[model samples]
Target: MNHAGPSPVPSIFPQFFAPGNGPTDFIVQDFAVVMIVAAMMMAITYKLKQPMVIGYILAGIVIGPFTPPFSLIKEADTLNVLAELGIIMLLFVIGTEFPMARLRTMGKISFAVAIVESTGTLLIVFFAAQALGFSFFDSLFLSLALSITSTVVTIKVLEDLGWIKSKSSTLVLGMLIVEDIFVVTALAVLQSFAAGGGEFSLPGLAVSLGVTGAFIAGVLVLGSRYIPRIIDRAGKTNDYALLLIVILGLAFGLSFLSTGIGLSSAIGAFLAGVLVAESNSAAVARILTLPLRDMFAAIFFVSIGALMNVSLVPMFIIPAAILILTSFASKLLIITGVLVRAKFDNVTALRAGFGMSTARGELSLVVVKGGQDVGAVSSTILPLLGVITVVTTFLAPYVIRFGNKITLTETKKSDGSSNMEESSSGVG
Candidate 1:
């Protein structure tokens, strides 16, 4: 055997500063700084009982090129790539946790609620954007950014309030699942439209929708039947390492294939998750993926903040304010009305409405970022949506709390009335 000269003792001090195939020292340093700042900000927000999403965004803004005290990042391209990866991971996790069976349990009522709320908000925001001198595409993209609510923020608030198991929360979550499906599907069609040159062509739009619909159907049908078996087999090996690798392979593989087919990588990653979720080993996959998901998701939010030009906030203040008000009011009222129409009580309707109204955080940012990526929307839309996301995310907990208090008081009064009636009957 040709003894490869006893592998020259590897340098104990590895080349930290030398040119290499991997990211440079500066990139690693920048990442460390980002994580440190993110941790500090998140800790502060946690202490203040606010969403850590706000902290992550603030940290990004602080370190971003757009902000004061000099930019921390050397080149944005690497960070952007990481951010894109982060988005893929975030959406993949969303797909895995998607309440497919739960949607069935809630039935069409939740779907109706989601459709009405999303449509109502979109139309209102679209017209508002048009009236404000935005381009047609800008208006359309703005409408989408405002229409979708942040499932992450909503669930966090529900958990904090110990209301996750409440009837209203259940309904709100179900409605959100439907809303997510609608938004993702819409994103695919819109991306196809953007690929076709960002113009309104009815025939092109139809073609995009048809292809997207067909693609989704085929993936779900075929993937559900086969991907689960692979997962089950992996699980059978009792090799967690192997299982994790397989899951990642599926996510990236499907994402690449989707892009190859001219669809957003997000859709593919999400679909990959959906397929994995169908498996008996979904719980295992989720457990294995959570840490990775959380890390990348944080990076995604930070990247969104970094891309935002805070100075432009003054310029888009009016539009941002208009959208915030229009979206909040439209979503709340539309959802409440629909729920009432669906036979839910007034208190329940109000609670669900308030729960779903605010916190347009992650998905909103994703949509606007996607639009910007495709040059379908103006650059200003990112900062505008950033403003909307921060404001709404900050207010989400308070809004849900107010709704809870209202329902609690109503319940107490109703209980009092019942007790009074019993006492009167006994006295009689």
Candidate 2:
């Protein structure tokens, strides 16, 4: 007591004494944890010859709130914001791959396949959802949710399977573009319906479509003219950083513009990419922005995984299982038939169908989330969708790989025709 209570104890960690707690610490910690876990899982999957997407999603599940261990993420909103950025960047990259000429070339067949497949999926899923006892609105929302395929996941799967340059791959990409357009239109109708403006508000729907069409036209006409000129001038400086900044600025600027007009930011970012791609600087810009696109894209998938609510899965197991099975089968059949009708060979049609069947990831998530936000979809649908997406995404790569193997065999058979010609010429 006389010695001042044996001296005051000094703590080893002094950073705690700095200031008031804020989001910075939480964000840093959460991000570090997510990245570390994701990296480790990715390594494990690589050793097993699996896609990195599975690892990223599993990493999210490990640290997510639904898991047994306590959640490590304290700033979910920050993660969401980053995920949104990832979406924009991903779409921007996709847009860069499609110039106006390419779009025009792919338009007819792509639109045919997309319209048939999407409409077929919607009708099938709608009736199936109703048979499963969902309400009219819920069935409508669910059908829409499952209609649009996940362009990101499908492309990743195709690339991983080494089929990215195949004829079917081209059709798949084209179909995705068509689906994106349909999704924009569907979202507008859904928003109107959710607001109690009736299921088919002629005036509202017309206005929405008109605005969207005008925006696209304007971007293609004006942006194609100006953006390339600006990028060319900027590229003359030969500064990689400056080129990247300009590209990103255009991407984000267009994304913001799209959102302001009630369209998806992804569409705008894509258009921006398309404009930039028309420029001579496209190659340089793609190379410079690749890393940023990849990094954020990983975060986006992880955030999707983090949103999974495992406990709710058991509540709708029967319906979810049915929906997944029927949705996959129907889409596969519909897409295959459409491709065949469009003059694609049997193997190519089947391959395209299989690839398209695995398209229930990001776009489905958007539809479901939009419905929930507007009170048109029930909270119960979230986990069901999460489970369906995970299952389909995990299976997609294998399915595509199998299809590729079959296509390769068909190619070899076709090559045999060349041998027949050679033999006939020698005999002659």
Candidate 2 segments exceeding 4 Å error: 1-19, 134-141, 188-199, 369-376, 404-428
Clashes of each: 0, 1
Task: Output the number of the lDDT-best candidate.
Answer: 1
* Candidate 1 lDDT tens digits, 298-391: 8888877887788788998877888899999999999888888877777788889999998998888878777777788887888888888999
Model 2 poorest 10 in a row by lDDT: 419-428
RMSD of each: 8.2, 7.7
Encode model 2's per-residue lDDT on 6-123: one tens digit a residue. 1111133336323465778767766776778778888898898765666777777776666554565655576567667877887788778878877787768778889888888999
Q: Whole-model lDDT for model 1 versus the true structure?
A: 0.82
- The global C-alpha lDDT for each of the candidates, from Candidate 1 onward, is 0.82, 0.75
In Å, residue 398's CA in model 2 sits off its true spot by 3.0
